[model samples]
Target: KAAGSALMKNEKLVEDIIKSVVNAVNIPVTLKMRTGWNEENKNAPTIAKIAEDNGIKMLAIHGRTRAQKYNGDAEYDTVKKIKGIVSIPVVANGDITSAEKAKKVLDYTGADAVMLGRATQGNPWLVGQINNYITTGKTSKAPSLDKKISLILKHILQIHDFYGHKMGTQLSRKHIFWYSMHLDQEKGSDFWPNINRVSNHSEQYLKFHDFLYSI
Candidate 1:
């Protein structure tokens, strides 16, 4: 988790892992890491150096210290410094929720690219949206109501396929909460208590559709 050390603390341990991965494969190697262990122990530059000293071709930096977690705005200044110190491509991550934010991050951090996390949870189309804007300088049309419903169904099916019925259904409930909140602004905290009472995936899906229909 974010509370733990960013990547593993032992430098040799990481080198060994990278060496093994490099030996096992014929292509480039990359690593993902947070700003550092905590506010005081922000060793991202050191870690980036260690990774570079090894064969890592790229490094992605999540711009929050372990102590910060997801509570505050990501610190792009640290990422900027990492880019200054490291020769490999540096990717920035954390709270990149929109194309505008993505562009700002790339410019601010001076990273080769930006990584999107929670922003893509229910909005995977964002990747294409960002690409369209970056390439064409225009945003795409919003998805139609019918497309939104279909995407909800598709997401449910994918979750069900990846995780079995019981677990998938359980996990889908949280996503359903997010969908409910986004699709129908009126359904606020009041809907969450009943979410646990929904019997199964079919019932939950039906409830969601009914809620959407009411909107």
Candidate 2:
């Protein structure tokens, strides 16, 4: 839906803006963009060259075009094409769920780097794990059940502190949902809709602890 009317839909205008910002700033300027407005207009290569010509220091492209909106597997051919067309560093993004997938994307696209977004919601340590594997070619052990439960609780509390109780609890619902998605695989399934309904900090903690102690 958003892809149909992206703010950066006009390539020429966006290129002009990038040129102005590049000329105006002393610091490096980077551009992040989708493949195009839709499948018919996968103009990532065109925009990558424009940014390079306009002095962008780097380019990061999500493998899925704007229209795809994370519905399917990310395609690396476009990123590879963009890298071929531009001399500046290009980073590939999308569906990099694990360290192995990260390595696979880098190897397939020959991208200068890889980026993560949705994969890091409650699993922030994934970045460290991915980095360790990428740099050392050795897999790190997954966090223990107790450690993961502790981390999820800590994460909810951090959000509560940062956003204040009301907004934080509301914002935390999705994070808790994602966290539970992983937890269900390990622990015997139980808390779900019941757990997500918890909005207040005290109640959330109570329910979380109950879920943990029960199993």
Candidate 3:
């Protein structure tokens, strides 16, 4: 959602955010933003100072403008320049995947860190893998079948409990799709039948259990 023109144009929202959040908490303040609103209004540097001056401790910039949507290559040059202009730590985000890509982004953008988004879907251990490779030169072995099943079941239970049987069950379908899509050919097809039949929370759990027992 777009902010009102007055609020977006005032340019003091950054400082105000730092003031309010910094005053309200004892922890460090961090700001996340796009590459300004659009091309001609690339005011991240100006916003960065407002944050820094008002007590923000770190900044994260996604490498895209409002006009780009998710199209085209993410522009790291703006992120690189923001790192140069800001005194606080800067983190880069947008379409980052793999350890080598992470390394390349940090180097190219001169960011203090890289923020992983969609690439971490069903691959939560990615951060650990990249961190291990960067610090120890090795990625951990992939999770075994038993571990994968355990994680899927646990996640389903948590979602069901949090959102209740109805909404939680509805929410779990996508998660189930994500978890089961990587199974080997025979089991993959078997899993799809169970997933598609799910209509409610109890059915989802039952289907999941049935698929697991089949494995």
User: What's the TM-score of every candidate structure?
Assistant: 0.83, 0.85, 0.80
- Which candidate, 1 or 3, has the higher lDDT? 1
lDDT of 2 by residue, 1-215 (tens): 32332744787787778889998989999988888878898888888898899899999998777777778888899999998889999999888999999999998889999999999876777998999999999999778878888877888789889999888888877877677666674442456767677767778767766776555
Worst 10 residues of 2 by lDDT: 1-10
**lDDT tens digits by residue: candidate 1, 11-79:** 666677778897799899899888876787888888888888878999998888877878888888889
Q: How far out, in Å, is residue 166 in model 2?
A: 1.0
Candidate 3 ranges beyond 4 A from true positions: 4-10, 182-199, 211-215
- Best by the TM-score measure: 2
Which regions of candidate 2 deviate over 4 angstroms? 1-9, 20-27, 185-190
What's the true lDDT of residue 72 in model 2? Answer: 84
RMSD of each: 2.8, 2.8, 3.4
lDDT of each: 0.79, 0.82, 0.77
Tens-digit lDDT track of model 3 for 132-215: 777777767657878877887899999999999878988887777666655454676667776765677777887787686567
**Candidate 1: stretches off by over 4 Å:** 1-12, 24-29
